[model samples]
Target chain A: MSRRPEPVQVVKERRDAALDTLVGGLPYLAFLGIRFERRGDELTAVLPFRDENIGNPLLPALHGGVTAAFLETAAVVELAWSQLWPQMEGGAGAAAPGVRPPLPRTIDFTVDFLRSGLPRDAYARAVVVRQGRRYASVRVEGWQDNRARLFAQASGHFMMPDLSAGPGAAFADDEAMDPAPPASEPR
Target chain B: MSDDQYLRIAQQFIEALPHARVLGLRLLSVSPGHAEIELPWAAHLVGDPATGVLHGGAVSTLMDTCGGAAVMAHPAANAGAATLDLRIDYMRAATPGQAVRARAECLRVTRSVAFVRATASDDDVERPVALMQGAFTLHAPRLAGEAT
Candidate 1:
């Protein structure tokens, strides 16, 4: 019998694959101009400001929704990067056929607007508070110039899939394939 | 000011935000202390492409816009408002191929703050996809003699 890849190795592979396709596979994040930078195991979300992201044109502040969305995406992407397995509804072997890695479902989200987000490059940092068998909790904070001067802080809960339970479990998803072409390319 | 004037202001407020336009949010109607907005579905906005469901962030945008609009339409709000805090509970994923509607009401208004409660649904109002509650910070103080 071929030796099965350890669950930890599988998670690392999945995390690397997700980073490669972070843009094309996730179209919405691209639309919002969200990018990721990984340093060792830490992931930071970068949101470059565009005219479309401005909420208060007068103050030239980023839209509350834009900030919130950035924070939420940061939380989800961080969870995946950390390779925390959420319990799957169907068994691990019951894999769905797709190239895009399965993303956790958001159960609850709360955002606190600490300060108005100025129109500029914004960055978010997310930390997974806890990872249980079926659910995971994450805390994310967004800032512009000074990290201490946080524009927004958020807490969210996501449902994870159990990926370590079965063989071929982690590599079954088509997301294991190379990244897709850019959105501009024809399907 | 009259509700009609406040309604017009609310519409302009929604139009001014480019992100709101990106989501294709339409102002359905507005009355004093209340606002309604609609979001048309698009393929690129889906959070879960496998399931083809709208992303939670899109829903949050819709709800936040409505909540802010409700504050703008409030009679006591002489100036615009900003979101102080917002909470969303995802009851279920929004069905794909359906437009989402969000309606928010300013439950109360004080000198410097306005409270809002809102909901987002696709076809059926009874079975909502998400629920939201938020508070907005009023730019100006309450109008004279306005209800507390």
Candidate 2:
């Protein structure tokens, strides 16, 4: 009889082939339910609006806390799309799939709100003014409908990590471990 | 809670919103998305121990509110919307023992969205210490007569 090969222990796994840069995040951001979608230069996403988020009554709108969250999400996602296109289009990025580096650390960001958000679903769209070698500039716009009035707008500057250093990421312990088995897994 | 009370709503916002702290953020004035707000340099807001500069989070909070109010003051949709997201980048630490104020203006407002830009500084508006921009949505009515 042929000798059986030793069992191979699956030590690592991934969702989209190679999304290394995506999973590494601070505990606070994960706690806040931030999501990133790489959809090319024209990026869009929805922040789940909840009534309980109102914090400051003096300004009285959707608390500024929530507003900042949206801006941060858009910035990272926009860059991802720009960086990921080649991979998706069957170039170099596609071969690696999920091994992209973590987003560059932010250096400085500026946000301006033209109007207050009422208690309603909000949508956001981002347009990049310039995506350069060391830094990238983006303009994100949030709205409910397309009534020409915006809920918020954002512009940000981020410092790209050296490719050799690979975004200098540190993963949380809990996040580093394997996710629990799904309920549908065979017993 | 008097309906006619002329006091600024900063206290009430803190009283009800447990997770959201004031962080020494104060309103200087509100004029059609063109407004001024302040951040007091206190013990709790300091991030560094040696020089005692204000924390980045504190400046971020001030920017968030100042920008939001600037948008709310827009003439198009007075009811207000919700904040889908906000992002801030700290240029550097601020000088200790000095209060900082921000000047904000609404750049544009759509039926569904509002845009704003702001600058923060201690004694100089020309050389801003920090820059901020945000977007807001409009509000619709809930059960009973209410404006959220």
Error of 2 at A15 (Å): 8.8
Per-residue lDDT for A112-145 in model 1, tens only?
9988887789999999999886689999999888
What TM-score goes with each of the models? 0.80, 0.50
Identify the candidate with maximal TM-score. 1
lDDT of 1 by residue, B23-73 (tens): 899898998788899999898887756667777888899999999888887
- Chain B TM-score in candidate 1, rounded to 2 decimals? 0.87
lDDT of 2 by residue, A74-125 (tens): 6656665566545454424433444545444445665565566655666777
Best by lDDT: 1
Window of ten residues with lowest summed lDDT in model 1 chain A: A85-94
The residue ranges of model 1 lying beyond 4 angstroms of the native Cα positions read A1-16, A84-98, A164-187, B1-9, B140-148
**lDDT (CA) per prediction:** 0.78, 0.56
